[model samples]
Target: MTMAAMAVLPSRFIKCFSLSSASAPVSTLQEIASASPQGVAKVVLKKGKTQLFKYGSPMVYSGAVDRIIGRPPPKTGEVVLVADGAEVPIGWGLYNSVSMFCVRLMQLEEEASREPTCALNMERLLEHRINAATDLRRQLGLPSINTNAYRLVNSEGDRLSGLIVDVFGDVAVVASSAAWVEKYKQEIEAFINKVDGISHINWRPSVDILKEEGLDLLQLKHASVASPSQVEVKENGIRYAISLEGQKTGFYADQRENRQFISTIAKGKRVLDVCCYSGGFSLNAAHGGAVSVTGVDSSMPALELAEKNIVLNGLDSERITFLKQDASDFMKKAAARNETWDIVVLDPPKLAPRKEVLQNASGMYRNLNALAMRLTKKGGVLMTCSCSGAMTQSGTFMRVIQGAAAMAGRKVTILRQAGAASDHPIDPSYPEGAYLSNIMLRVL
Candidate 1:
């Protein structure tokens, strides 16, 4: 990152890289910018921040940045090298001046020991991380053996924060959250196409993430290719019809294993899948031999797909039903009618988008869980989940559910706990990456 290091670099290689290989016609300015580190800047971090980076952390907040080591700091989405106290290279990251989490680190030299494929160039770094991540999934027997729909790239979890790629059968949905990733969209798309079995690619913008990072879309122009709007995917032998316009990256692939777990225990029982987006769990419950299954969701489009999923699986019509209604209203009504279910699932949308909403989100969790507890039959199972990572402080989510159980005059015991499937591995350094939290409880 020092000025002296620039002296040895060749001038001809300094030009921005072409969007495609030598044969294809070169196009797009942003693509070229993201393709090469022609003018990557340098950033110096404060003393304590170096330790986190040393331990393989991928995010450096604005407060952690001490000063610009060079004459000019990089623009939003531009690459930058982070220097330590003694000007040692900590790693390279996407520098976004506007974002609170300013630097989304891409490569760290310290990780070279553990991650042998780590590299310096932006393009090489992405390719290295993508290959490593996919290789890990293959090792875990992910899409190949278990489910075709799975999380391919988990942002920070895969050493690429602010970006998430979910694979649904032959389709891959690229959900970009950070401003830095906007520039590299085309390159990332090209890399994804290289992976086998990925014929179609869809671009689903993570507008909420973009807004949270305070990234100005005008400055960070994005590029992508067109693909299908819907695709059918198989999970543990159950087929689901998913829409590209639906929830996060089209579908919640994180719950792949959890749905299968529910199926193993759903035999001959009445199951209630609350906030069952696209009926993943509902379909699994019915396929698992549930006596009756009811799925509740507010999204008509999702409910329509969920209904389609039932027929796609060839499940009996009388054994499964889909309801387009608010989860809370349905739960309240079910309690009023004294309708009991052997197993009740409460997987609501992210209640706490950020730390600021943690308290309110906890309250929502408590109330909804209380309603779910009241609706469950005695000795039944209650599967509660929260995708809000900021709010799930170790046992905070379970504590909230326990508090709700106390309020509802019910006794609940933790039977099983689970989270994102193996594909979504959590880096010990990045606690925030542990977004999906699911716990099964036996209610009395």
Candidate 2:
């Protein structure tokens, strides 16, 4: 059993609760059966609407939903079931009416394989999912190697739709979109502690998501004693100091292999890293023996961190230059000086957060990549990438790069295309899950 203690947050309406467990709380199917009437909400689907759940996809948008029945729409992440027009159950998932993704359905193959129409066994299933995601990384020999930081559990990829846990050394930085995690925080922490080398856990609450979802922050955020926000992590033998409150679970661990890949070809080359937040690629290039490495970014904190990282890694201080300037402006200045590099990297911020803005985002990408291409010496390598999943598909990004090359009046041959690291697995059923689009091209 778990006990909860509540404390007041900055907002009087918000109260934080912490739970303590005397021992490992092992939940059984019976708990779900007993809580079914209280926790589970029912959703009815319109006629002939079954394609999404059939494909093992987890999203149920507002348009596809029929009238909700029973238990008050699951109280924002309470478990809910989607039934067909005939009221036959399809699958169960967490419900959030305010978000366009009203409910995220879960596949019950194992439970259905045993007993059809049985209530959800959430705790047991969550444990199984976390363990399975972690075990695969173990089999891949990830944290065992010199790397101590990587994505431990990818959100939908790991089947825990609204949860993300990225491990940085002994610390597990967890982000949650579902209220279910809030309700069972201690148990979930226990499950994460089961992962090898994880003893500390940090909660990252999305206050912005709370406002966007039209939910009261008081109802969502819990007041908890704060810990030091900064932590140091090592990736691929490189040391990095990161803040938990910083971007995307502290750092871009998904680019682990991608950074190393660029390093292999960096030796004796003049390298340029655009949008070089914290100098991830630039530092790798310097370590890989690049003759000169230049990084450009607008963030002062990131540039300062890059300088610190350079010193921490014991790299040559003179070899890398971190410039505080807009990436596009820096590229134009280099081109004006008739400067060219043997390797040019272009990785911009997410220009398209939504599908409706793809055309505008495409124009920005085209301009950026074209500038990078123009600065690439003959036979030099151009590493271009896009991380916006909402708009930039793999093929679409490549096409944009090709258009950039055409605009730059340069001939290019694709050397290789890459995606996220092994730890950031892509579910085959949901190809859009593969967000990172990287292409290495030889410019002529």
Give the alpha-carbon lDDT of every model: 0.82, 0.79
Per-residue CA lDDT of model 2 for 1-444, tens digit only, reads 122322323433332222222353322333443465465556888776776666777778778887888744457756676766765566777777688777777654335445434347567767878888988888878795578888888877888776888888888998876655666677788899888787788887666765555567777665563445777788888888777777777888878888999889999999999999988899889989899999999999888889889888988878999999998888899889989999998888888777888888988999999999999999999999888996445357877888998999998999988888999887776666777887899999
Clashes of each: 0, 2
Instruction: Let me know the TM-score candidate 1 reaches against the reference structure.
Output: 0.87
| Model 1 per-residue lDDT at 307 | 83
lDDT winner? 1
- Residue 234 shift from truth in candidate 2, angstroms: 1.7
For each of the candidates, the C-alpha root-mean-square deviation to the true structure, in angstroms, is 10.5, 14.2
lDDT of 1 by residue, 44-90 (tens): 89987798887877888889888886446567777777778766666
Clash pairs detected, candidate 2: 16-222, 16-223
Clashing pairs in 1: none
Error of 1 at 312 (Å): 0.5
